[model samples]
Target: MAMEKTKETHPHTLGECTKSILPVRDALEVLSGKWKLPIIISLMFGNKRFSQIAKEVPGITDKMLSKELRELESNDLVKRTVYDSIPVVVEYSLTEYGHSLEIVIKTLRDWGVAHRKRMMVAE
Candidate 1:
Protein backbone atom coordinates (compact mmCIF):
# COMPACT_ATOMS: atom_id res chain seq x y z
CA MET A 1 0.00 0.00 0.00
CA ALA A 2 1.08 3.64 -0.47
CA MET A 3 0.88 4.20 3.29
CA GLU A 4 3.28 1.34 3.89
CA LYS A 5 5.74 2.82 1.40
CA THR A 6 5.45 6.23 3.07
CA LYS A 7 6.09 4.70 6.48
CA GLU A 8 9.15 2.84 5.24
CA THR A 9 10.56 5.83 3.38
CA HIS A 10 10.02 8.23 6.27
CA PRO A 11 10.88 6.05 9.22
CA HIS A 12 12.01 8.99 11.34
CA THR A 13 8.68 10.70 11.62
CA LEU A 14 7.60 11.99 15.02
CA GLY A 15 5.53 8.94 15.84
CA GLU A 16 8.21 6.54 14.70
CA CYS A 17 10.92 8.47 16.54
CA THR A 18 8.86 8.51 19.69
CA LYS A 19 8.41 4.76 19.53
CA SER A 20 12.08 4.25 18.84
CA ILE A 21 13.05 6.37 21.82
CA LEU A 22 10.51 5.15 24.32
CA PRO A 23 13.14 3.18 26.23
CA VAL A 24 15.27 6.29 26.63
CA ARG A 25 12.24 8.22 27.78
CA ASP A 26 11.40 5.57 30.34
CA ALA A 27 14.99 5.50 31.59
CA LEU A 28 15.01 9.25 31.91
CA GLU A 29 11.73 9.20 33.74
CA VAL A 30 13.43 7.07 36.39
CA LEU A 31 16.95 8.52 36.27
CA SER A 32 16.49 12.12 35.14
CA GLY A 33 16.87 14.37 38.16
CA LYS A 34 19.41 16.25 40.21
CA TRP A 35 19.83 13.55 42.85
CA LYS A 36 18.99 10.10 41.47
CA LEU A 37 22.25 9.45 39.66
CA PRO A 38 24.33 10.96 42.42
CA ILE A 39 22.59 8.86 44.97
CA ILE A 40 23.27 5.80 42.87
CA ILE A 41 26.88 6.82 42.56
CA SER A 42 27.15 7.25 46.27
CA LEU A 43 25.91 3.73 46.87
CA MET A 44 28.49 2.32 44.49
CA PHE A 45 31.06 2.34 47.26
CA GLY A 46 28.89 -0.17 49.11
CA ASN A 47 25.87 -0.14 51.38
CA LYS A 48 25.66 3.08 53.37
CA ARG A 49 23.51 4.49 56.07
CA PHE A 50 21.23 7.42 55.43
CA SER A 51 23.56 9.87 57.16
CA GLN A 52 26.51 8.54 55.22
CA ILE A 53 24.85 8.97 51.84
CA ALA A 54 23.77 12.48 52.75
CA LYS A 55 27.33 13.37 53.66
CA GLU A 56 28.74 11.82 50.51
CA VAL A 57 26.23 13.43 48.14
CA PRO A 58 26.77 16.91 49.62
CA GLY A 59 24.13 19.68 49.59
CA ILE A 60 21.15 17.29 49.55
CA THR A 61 18.71 18.04 52.32
CA ASP A 62 17.29 15.26 54.50
CA LYS A 63 13.84 15.71 53.05
CA MET A 64 15.13 15.59 49.49
CA LEU A 65 17.26 12.54 50.18
CA SER A 66 14.38 10.67 51.75
CA LYS A 67 12.11 11.50 48.85
CA GLU A 68 14.66 10.51 46.22
CA LEU A 69 15.52 7.27 48.01
CA ARG A 70 11.86 6.35 48.06
CA GLU A 71 11.62 6.99 44.35
CA LEU A 72 14.70 4.89 43.65
CA GLU A 73 13.37 2.11 45.86
CA SER A 74 10.06 2.15 44.10
CA ASN A 75 11.90 1.84 40.82
CA ASP A 76 13.89 -1.15 42.18
CA LEU A 77 17.10 0.74 41.78
CA VAL A 78 17.92 0.79 45.48
CA LYS A 79 17.19 -1.42 48.44
CA ARG A 80 16.58 -0.25 51.96
CA THR A 81 17.42 -2.60 54.79
CA VAL A 82 16.40 -2.10 58.35
CA TYR A 83 18.16 -3.85 61.17
CA ASP A 84 17.03 -4.52 64.66
CA SER A 85 19.19 -2.78 67.12
CA ILE A 86 18.86 -0.72 70.22
CA PRO A 87 18.41 2.38 68.15
CA VAL A 88 17.33 0.72 64.89
CA VAL A 89 19.68 1.01 61.94
CA VAL A 90 18.67 1.47 58.33
CA GLU A 91 20.96 1.23 55.35
CA TYR A 92 20.60 1.74 51.64
CA SER A 93 22.29 -0.11 48.84
CA LEU A 94 21.83 -0.74 45.17
CA THR A 95 19.74 -3.68 44.16
CA GLU A 96 20.78 -6.12 41.46
CA TYR A 97 18.72 -4.07 39.05
CA GLY A 98 20.55 -0.96 40.16
CA HIS A 99 23.90 -2.66 39.68
CA SER A 100 22.84 -3.11 36.07
CA LEU A 101 23.32 0.60 35.60
CA GLU A 102 27.08 0.43 36.09
CA ILE A 103 27.75 0.51 32.39
CA VAL A 104 25.60 3.55 31.83
CA ILE A 105 27.10 5.30 34.83
CA LYS A 106 30.62 4.63 33.68
CA THR A 107 29.84 5.81 30.19
CA LEU A 108 28.45 9.05 31.54
CA ARG A 109 31.49 9.53 33.75
CA ASP A 110 33.83 8.99 30.84
CA TRP A 111 31.88 11.34 28.61
CA GLY A 112 31.73 13.95 31.34
CA VAL A 113 35.47 13.85 31.77
CA ALA A 114 36.02 14.28 28.06
CA HIS A 115 33.45 17.07 27.88
CA ARG A 116 35.14 18.92 30.72
CA LYS A 117 38.47 18.69 28.97
CA ARG A 118 36.94 19.91 25.73
CA MET A 119 35.36 22.86 27.52
CA MET A 120 38.63 23.75 29.17
CA VAL A 121 40.43 23.67 25.85
CA ALA A 122 37.76 25.90 24.34
CA GLU A 123 38.27 28.48 27.05
Candidate 2:
Protein backbone atom coordinates (compact mmCIF):
# COMPACT_ATOMS: atom_id res chain seq x y z
CA MET A 1 0.00 0.00 0.00
CA ALA A 2 2.77 2.41 0.89
CA MET A 3 4.70 1.44 -2.20
CA GLU A 4 1.62 1.99 -4.34
CA LYS A 5 1.31 5.49 -2.93
CA THR A 6 4.98 6.15 -3.65
CA LYS A 7 4.57 4.83 -7.19
CA GLU A 8 1.54 6.97 -7.77
CA THR A 9 3.53 10.03 -6.72
CA HIS A 10 6.00 9.31 -9.52
CA PRO A 11 3.71 8.71 -12.46
CA HIS A 12 6.60 8.75 -14.94
CA THR A 13 8.54 6.17 -13.00
CA LEU A 14 5.48 3.99 -12.61
CA GLY A 15 4.68 4.23 -16.29
CA GLU A 16 8.24 3.35 -17.23
CA CYS A 17 8.28 0.41 -14.87
CA THR A 18 4.94 -0.89 -16.12
CA LYS A 19 5.89 -0.34 -19.73
CA SER A 20 9.10 -2.31 -19.47
CA ILE A 21 7.52 -5.17 -17.55
CA LEU A 22 4.84 -6.17 -20.03
CA PRO A 23 7.24 -6.60 -22.96
CA VAL A 24 9.70 -8.48 -20.77
CA ARG A 25 6.92 -10.76 -19.57
CA ASP A 26 5.71 -11.32 -23.14
CA ALA A 27 9.26 -12.12 -24.26
CA LEU A 28 9.64 -14.55 -21.39
CA GLU A 29 6.40 -16.21 -22.35
CA VAL A 30 7.77 -16.98 -25.80
CA LEU A 31 11.31 -17.81 -24.70
CA SER A 32 10.53 -19.65 -21.49
CA GLY A 33 11.06 -23.42 -20.97
CA LYS A 34 14.19 -25.52 -21.16
CA TRP A 35 14.26 -26.26 -24.88
CA LYS A 36 13.28 -23.04 -26.66
CA LEU A 37 16.56 -21.17 -26.20
CA PRO A 38 18.63 -24.21 -27.04
CA ILE A 39 16.60 -24.77 -30.18
CA ILE A 40 16.98 -21.13 -31.14
CA ILE A 41 20.72 -21.26 -30.51
CA SER A 42 21.00 -24.32 -32.73
CA LEU A 43 19.32 -22.55 -35.62
CA MET A 44 21.61 -19.57 -35.06
CA PHE A 45 24.51 -21.52 -36.47
CA GLY A 46 22.75 -22.41 -39.72
CA ASN A 47 19.56 -23.80 -41.15
CA LYS A 48 18.95 -27.42 -40.20
CA ARG A 49 16.51 -30.29 -40.48
CA PHE A 50 14.36 -31.59 -37.65
CA SER A 51 16.78 -34.45 -36.95
CA GLN A 52 19.71 -32.08 -37.03
CA ILE A 53 18.12 -29.73 -34.48
CA ALA A 54 17.43 -32.73 -32.25
CA LYS A 55 21.07 -33.68 -32.51
CA GLU A 56 22.22 -30.19 -31.59
CA VAL A 57 19.86 -29.49 -28.68
CA PRO A 58 20.20 -33.05 -27.27
CA GLY A 59 17.91 -34.73 -24.70
CA ILE A 60 14.81 -33.07 -26.22
CA THR A 61 12.07 -35.45 -27.30
CA ASP A 62 10.76 -35.30 -30.85
CA LYS A 63 7.29 -34.26 -29.72
CA MET A 64 8.64 -31.42 -27.62
CA LEU A 65 10.90 -30.22 -30.41
CA SER A 66 8.04 -30.24 -32.86
CA LYS A 67 5.86 -28.37 -30.43
CA GLU A 68 8.56 -25.79 -29.73
CA LEU A 69 9.25 -25.30 -33.41
CA ARG A 70 5.59 -24.74 -34.08
CA GLU A 71 5.47 -22.15 -31.33
CA LEU A 72 8.56 -20.44 -32.67
CA GLU A 73 7.14 -20.43 -36.17
CA SER A 74 3.89 -19.00 -34.95
CA ASN A 75 5.80 -16.24 -33.18
CA ASP A 76 7.67 -15.37 -36.42
CA LEU A 77 10.94 -16.17 -34.77
CA VAL A 78 11.66 -19.15 -36.97
CA LYS A 79 11.15 -19.92 -40.62
CA ARG A 80 10.23 -23.40 -41.77
CA THR A 81 10.81 -24.19 -45.41
CA VAL A 82 9.41 -27.13 -47.30
CA TYR A 83 11.12 -28.30 -50.45
CA ASP A 84 9.06 -30.30 -52.86
CA SER A 85 11.36 -32.92 -54.18
CA ILE A 86 12.47 -36.45 -53.36
CA PRO A 87 11.31 -37.16 -49.79
CA VAL A 88 9.91 -33.61 -49.37
CA VAL A 89 12.68 -31.92 -47.47
CA VAL A 90 11.97 -29.51 -44.65
CA GLU A 91 14.39 -27.09 -43.00
CA TYR A 92 14.22 -24.68 -40.10
CA SER A 93 16.07 -21.40 -39.88
CA LEU A 94 15.90 -18.18 -37.93
CA THR A 95 13.70 -15.46 -39.34
CA GLU A 96 14.96 -11.87 -39.67
CA TYR A 97 13.06 -10.99 -36.54
CA GLY A 98 14.63 -13.90 -34.74
CA HIS A 99 18.09 -12.60 -35.54
CA SER A 100 17.26 -9.71 -33.25
CA LEU A 101 17.89 -12.05 -30.36
CA GLU A 102 21.58 -12.39 -31.19
CA ILE A 103 22.80 -9.77 -28.74
CA VAL A 104 20.43 -10.96 -26.02
CA ILE A 105 21.64 -14.54 -26.48
CA LYS A 106 25.27 -13.49 -26.36
CA THR A 107 24.66 -11.54 -23.17
CA LEU A 108 22.94 -14.58 -21.65
CA ARG A 109 25.84 -16.84 -22.61
CA ASP A 110 28.31 -14.48 -21.00
CA TRP A 111 26.20 -14.21 -17.86
CA GLY A 112 25.80 -17.97 -17.63
CA VAL A 113 29.54 -18.52 -17.89
CA ALA A 114 30.21 -15.87 -15.25
CA HIS A 115 27.55 -17.26 -12.93
CA ARG A 116 29.01 -20.76 -13.19
CA LYS A 117 32.45 -19.43 -12.32
CA ARG A 118 31.08 -17.38 -9.43
CA MET A 119 29.26 -20.40 -7.98
CA MET A 120 32.34 -22.56 -8.29
CA VAL A 121 34.40 -19.93 -6.53
CA ALA A 122 31.88 -19.53 -3.72
CA GLU A 123 32.11 -23.24 -2.98
Off by over 4 Å in 2: 1-15
TM-score of each candidate structure, all chains considered together? 0.85, 0.86
Pairs in clash, predicted candidate 2: none
Where is model 1 more than 4 Å wrong at Cα? 1-16
What's the CA RMSD for each of the models?
3.8, 3.4
Clashing pairs counted in every model = 0, 0
Candidate 1's C-alpha lDDT? Answer: 0.94
27-70 per-residue lDDT for model 2 (tens digits): 99999999999999999999999999998898999999999999
- lDDT for each residue of candidate 1 in 22-109, tens digit (9 for 90 to 100): 9999899999989999999999989999999999997999999999999999999999999999799999999999999999999999
